[model samples]
Target: MNSRAAQLQAFDRLLTIMDELREQCPWDKKQTMQTLRHLTIEETYELGDAILDNDLEEIKKELGDVLLHIVFYAKIGSEAKSFDIADVANEICKKLIHRHPHIYGDVKVKDEADVKRNWENIKLREGKKSVLEGVPKSLPALVKANRIQEKVAGVGFDWEEPHQVFEKLREELAEFQQEVKSNHKERMEAEFGDVLFSMINYARFLDINPENALERTNKKFMERFQYVERKAKDIGKSLQEMTLAEMDVFWEEAKTMDKRF
Candidate 1:
C-alpha cells in the first residue's frame, strides 16, 4: 500500500494528465457532461461487475476508469468557472463530517442502527423534505425499492421483527396469486411488483442484499445454460434439437462441476 504522501502524489499526477488530455486530445476537448453521462454509467456498471466477480485486478482498473470520469467532469466544471476538483472533494468531505456527528461532534450513538437514525434525522434537519428524497430517480427498480425501504426504515417506519416481514411477504404472495387467478394483466403486474418489493424487504430483514443475491443466481443460471449449450454442440446437436432430458443431464453435470450451486 502507498503512504499518504505517495497517494496524494499519484492523484496529482492524474490531475496533471487530465489537464493535458483536455488541452491536447480532440475527443476529450469536445466532450461535455451530457455526452459523457452514458459512458460514465457504463463504466460504473463495469466496476459493479468487477466487484461482484471479486476480481481485485479488474476492480482496480475499473476504479481508475471511474476516477478518470470524475476528474474529467471536474475539469469541465473548472473550464466553465463553476467548481473545480478541490471544490467537489471538499464539499463531500464537509458533508461527511456533518453527517457523522458521533465522530465529529459529541452526538451519542449506541449502535449502527442509532447512527442510521441519526443520519436520517440530520438530513431532515438539513431541509430534506423526506428521507426518500435521497434515493435517485434513475436507479434501477430493484435497487430503488431497496433504497426506499432502507430510507424509511432508518426513520423508524419498519416492521419490528423478521417474522413480521415474512408475514407481509406471504400476504403479498397471496395477493399476487389471487391476481394471477383473475388473469387481469394490469392487476397481476401491480400485485407482482408488490410481491417483489415485499420479498426485497424480507431479504433486508434477513441481512441479505437482494440485488446481489439475484445477480448471483442470474450468473449461475447463465453459466449452467452455457455449459448445456457446449455439451449439446459436443454431441453434434443444437439446443433446439436436444431433448429436455438431454439438456437436464448437462445442467446437472454443470452443477456438480461447481460447488457454489
Candidate 2:
C-alpha cells in the first residue's frame, strides 16, 4: 500500500542522485543533450523490447533508466539556469489538464476516438499549424507512416472504410510489382512505401495500431524461427544443412502452438 507521497519522495531521491552524478561524475558533468541523444534512443528501444517481451520487472528497470535521463537533462538545464525537473513535470501536468478537458473541465467526449480528436484539436489551438507537426521525422519508416496517417485522420482526412483502404493497398502493391519488373529501384521503393502506408491506413480503419500489429508479427516470426532451429537441433541437423521442406515442417508446427498469441 504505497502512497502517492511515498512515490514522490522516491522520485525526489532519484532526482537527488542525478544531481550528485552531474556535480561529481566527470562523464555525467561533460554530457550534453547532443551526446545523450543516441543513448536515449537506445534506452527507448530497450524499453520497447521489455514491453514486447511482457517482462514487467525489466520494464520497471528500463523506465527508471529513462527517468534518470530525464532528471539528468533537468540537472544540466538547472546548471545553465534554464529549468528543472519540476518545471518539466509541471508543464506536462498543465498540458494533460488542458488536453483532457472531459475530465478537468465540463467538455464532453463520447468515446476514446472523441478524446483523441479533441486532443489533436487542442494541439492545433495551442499553435501547431499542422496535425503532423509533433511526429518526429527520425521515427522508423513503418512507425512514421502510421503516425502520419493517424495525424492526418485526426484532422478529418482519411479513407472512408477498411475495404477501400485494402483496395488502395492492392493497387499500390501492383504498382510496386510493375516497378520491380521494369527494374526501377526508385519507383519500386516509392510504391513499396505507398503499399505500407495504405496497409497502415487499413489497420487504423479496423481500430488496430500498426506498430503493435507489426511488433506482434515480429514476435511471432522469432518464435517460429526459434522452433525451426530447435527442430533442426533435435534432428541432429544444422539449419544450414536443412532444406526448405524440412524447415516448413517445424514452421507449420510452430503455427499450431498456442503460445504464439
Steric clashes per prediction: 0, 0
* TM-score to true structure, per model: 0.98, 0.89
lDDT of 2 by residue, 1-261 (tens): 679999989988888788788879989989998899899999999999899889999999999889888888888788889998889999999999999999999999898878888989999999998888999989998889889888888767877778888998899999999999999889888888888888888888888988888898988899889989998999999999989998998999999884555
Candidate 2 residue 214 C-alpha distance from true site, Å? 1.8
C-alpha lDDT values of all predictions: 0.96, 0.88
Candidate 1 residues lying further than 4 Å off, grouped into runs, are: none
The number of the candidate with the highest lDDT is: 1
What's the lDDT for residue 40 in model 1? Answer: 99
Q: In candidate 1, what are the lDDT values of residues 101-213, reduced to their tens digit?
A: 99999999999999999999999999999999999999999999999999999999999999999999899999999999999999999999999999999999999999999
Candidate that would win on TM-score: 1
Tell me the lDDT of model 1 at 147: 96
